[model samples]
Target: MSQNDNNTDQKKSESHALVKSDENGHALTVKGKGRLLALTDSILKSAIASRKANQLAVDDSWMQEIWNWADSFTISEKKIPRNRQMLLGLTELDISGNLLEILPESIGNLTNLTELNLQQNMLSELPESIGNLTNLTKLNLQNNRLSELPESIGNLTNLTELSLRDNRLSELPESIGNLTNLTELSLRDNRLSELPESIGNLTNLTSLDIFGVRLSELPESIGNLTNLTELNLDYNNLSELPESIGQLNNLTRLDLSRNELSKLPESIGNLTNLIELDLSSNNNLSELPESIGNLTNLIVLDLSSNNKLSELPESIGNLTNLTELNLYNNRLNELPESISNLTNLIKLSLHGNKLSKLPENIGHLTNLTELDLWSHNLSELPESIGSLTNLTELNLGYNGLSELPESIGNLTNLTVLDLSNNELSKLPESIGNLTNLDSLSLHGNNLSELPESIGNLTNLIELFLSRNELSKLPESIGNLTNLIELFLSSNKLSELPESIGQLKNLTRLDLRNTMVRELPTSINQNRVKVIL
Candidate 1:
């Protein structure tokens, strides 16, 4: 018989045998928990030795020590688990945070145990006999020094959730494939560079996490996990995915962020059930598959930090159900007119891109409530944008816009508007129509004056107009009775506007390094902190 055959049979024998000791100085076999506890070590060892070929049990002393430990089981809450067999039939044990270094091999005596938690330990290895716990349904060995797993781990075929997160495991044993019933497995923050092809055998797996590994590629066999609903492979060195990945039709959420992937297989579009897909920080990704539009069920798509991407496919417009799309930190120079098809979009992030213009019909997304276009090269906004009556926040900072369309004041629902760091030299008197505006930022521009209409923002709470060419603040600024913080430093101001004292809610006022020569007497009665 092969050595492998011997080991297999050995495991089989131990599971069925009931041990005991006889009077002949030789151990005997008897059933039941019959206080076999009193059996002498030499007697038990002798009996174990007489057994035929299979190496059934370990040293008698070792077995006794395990039985003793089992009898010692008690919860640290200074209480025992409230089970009828609290002392004899422990089905669950959590000795986590105990700082144990070496787990005894005799732990396998727990044949009836269903759960074992040894998380947060300094243990560097698990005893080979650990596999004898055939009934274990959950095991948490996270945050340990386990550099390797025992091959017998395959014996715990009933484990549904196994977490080895934050461990030192460099690779999983090929025998892990025997756990066909596992549903969730976490190997995050490990040194694993590759997974065994046998992992594909986990057809029942629903979630698999391998984030923070050094894996550069996925095994092609990974596609066999058709029942998976969520998969996280973020922060790995993966530069490509297997074409077979499209087989995960049940997958609803997938994260492949922070990898080296330059392109994705077109098969990715086959995940019609995918609702959320994050491909952020893949620096080499230059474009997405045109088939990406096939994800009509998608609600969120994040492609941020892929700076090499210069454009998106027109087919992207097909994600009509998408509520959020993040394209931050890319090199996109133009937007597809098809974006108008995403009328359900609520939040759109396009910051740090090279976009010179926006889709003229972007207002078609009237459902949008937040729009982030900061740090782009946009010189102007299309007048059609005002059609987004639901917009509450608009960010156009660090752009080269010379002016805003007068239609901007039409977004009466806007609460936060940022137009700082632009080339604007003037504001249309119609700007004051934003009566619902709560905060406005227009600093670092060429504006020499404010339209008296600025007072129309009756709800304005915070206002920033620093570092501009402003020679004076519009008296309407004092009408912002809800103001709390006002920054107006480094401007060409010559004197304080008496209306400023009318700001009853203003708490902080900055006026350093400006041309202001004097203060209005009302400023004293208003108790405003003056920074001359």
Candidate 2:
């Protein structure tokens, strides 16, 4: 053989040594050989180091692809690529609000991740390999299309917070109970009909939100979560609660509003630690258990819109710590005298009820800032109302009151007062004593003339006296320099008060259907829009 032929043979031998083939005899390229050698070298180095080093040998091609995708992704004005480094060392990843539809199974290679947020995505399923992330402590998958979670998720025993809210999940895997360290879990706005019994295993849970789910009842196992401090089960189909619910004595806040519940379990009283309780909008609820009085620590209690609620248990007076009490739209005709014991109440709303009179001791609520008794059968108000010196807002509209008590002026702190649609023919001069008033509505009444004291409300921004029988406005009305809107429509006024020109801040003066035919030159010169 010639020298050239010998050189060619040597090169062929080198090439053959670098490449290999399968049993089928298809040759592997030199590039493939290089990759294989690199993988082998990594594995050998990992074996020589420690078990944790084995993770460093994982194929990083998948991560490289993810990095490439992240290059173009943005969330909340943050670029995900900015956090990237060597893939194996990644401990936290946030790709939320990216509209991502798939999560590659190779993601499990990121075993070092402790926090993963994929919320507000379109992902329909998670890879079972997710279980490989045993170090994960927080996982957020809210607002996704997930119909179910992989059982392997239970392997994340270190997880403390998991939010699967706004998903399509109808059921959870029993393995979920394995996450014993979980402290907060949110499944709000999902399609879940019931929770797995295994949920009780999460005794470390401090907060659990299952709002807007279709659950007709909660599992008895839920009672096992004695450490829970906040539990929200609003907007469900629950008609009754399991007695086991009383076991969660640590709960500080409980929301059971907008459900089909007709009665609450008497055991509910056991949650004495509760600071807020909402049981509103349960149309079937006619009476509350006397045990409700046991929640003495409550600061807010909402029992509104229960149409059949005709009376409250006198025990309600036991919640003296309450600051807000909403009992609007009920069938109650009279309030229990015990209600006066809620001396700490700041807001009391009883509108849309059949109440004809208020307790004479209502003045006991010295801290009251707002009182609403609209749409009731009240023909008169108790003189004791004058004692609510701290009152800022008072609504007695749509009542049968023919006159206000002369002591009404005692509410000097009043900023808004609505007494519309009443039988009042005249307002007490005391009405003017509310000098702090910014808005006063007295329309839809039988008033024939103005109270000169009305002019004393110099702070008034809006004065509504429409749909009344007023024949003339007091000249003192011009003293309201801060008035922005003056509604005098459907009244018998024949002409504008020359003092009206003094309202420099007036923007709208509605005089439609009034006897006035000409505009005040002062109003014509200003920017006021007069609606005739």
**lDDT of each model, Cα atoms only?**
0.88, 0.91
Query: Quick one: best TM-score, which candidate?
Result: 2
> Who wins the lDDT comparison?
2
In angstroms, how far off is 357's CA in candidate 2? 0.6
Candidate 2 displacement at residue 88 in angstroms: 0.8
Which ranges of candidate 2 are over 4 A from the true structure?
1-85
Root-mean-square deviation of every model: 12.0, 8.9
Residue lDDT tens for model 2, 1-532: 9999999987776666445564479865554456778866875776678644564444445666566666545333243333335566778888888898887777787899999999999989999989999999999999999999999999999999999999999999999999999999999999999999999999999999999989998999999999999999999999999999999999999999999999999999999999999999999999999999999999999999998999999999999999999999999999999999999999999999999999999989999999999999999999999999999999999999999999899999999999999999999999889999999999999999988888999999999999999999898999999999999999998998889999999999999899999877777555898888
TM-score of 1: 0.86
